[model samples]
Target: MKRLPGHGLRRGQAVTVTVDGEPTAAYLGESVAVALMAHGDLSTRATKGGENRGLFCGMGVCFDCVAVVDGVPGTRACVTWVRDGMVIERQDGPGARRAAPGG
Candidate 1:
């Protein structure tokens, strides 16, 4: 769902966040899922079978929107707010691991 301008909804200042090694625009106070979805990134994670998954429930009850954030795995994007320079990546599987430094 694209946010149309002139809606009169107050939004925080725009900032950039990195997703899958690419920079995307996001706003303060919005959830990480929102930031990713707004930038046309519908898939937040992938299952072991390589099936893409996206936001199912806006709330954190559902685990469909789990992603790796800031080198941590299994983070729920729906409840995590977007921060400037935040790094986010889709989880490839249940055993996704953070890359080693300088590798």
Candidate 2:
């Protein structure tokens, strides 16, 4: 998932976010979905039957791109902005429970 030519030249400050415990490069103000896609990781979560789901209806009309962010589950990756040191993990299914604070 290569970025459009010249599109990378006008991005916000560079930042690093941890995705699935792996350090992934991202930019401030960029949505987590964009960052994930740019890193060649399209699937954000899976269905109960194990079907992978990713970016869809980029305007947030859909909830197919949900993932756990910074210990919070079911976050819409398409709208959540990336921040330095942000922790992101690909969710497994729709039954994910909210992570306990500081846990």
Model 1, 1-103: lDDT tens digits are 5678888888898989988777999999999999778767698888888888889988999889998999888899999999999998878787484233375
Q: Which portions of model 2 show Cα errors greater than 4 Å?
A: 1-9, 95-103
Model 2 lDDT, residue 84, Cα: 96
**Which pairs of residues collide in candidate 1?**
none
Q: How far off is residue 96 in model 1, in Å?
A: 1.8
Listed per model in order, the count of residue pairs whose N, CA or C atoms clash below 3 Å is: 0, 0
lDDT of each: 0.84, 0.83
Which one wins on lDDT? 1
Best by TM-score: 1
TM-score of 1: 0.83
Determine the C-alpha RMSD for candidate 1 after optimal superposition of all C-alphas. Answer: 3.9
Candidate 2 residue 67 Cα shift, in angstroms, is 0.4
Q: What are the models' TM-scores?
A: 0.83, 0.82
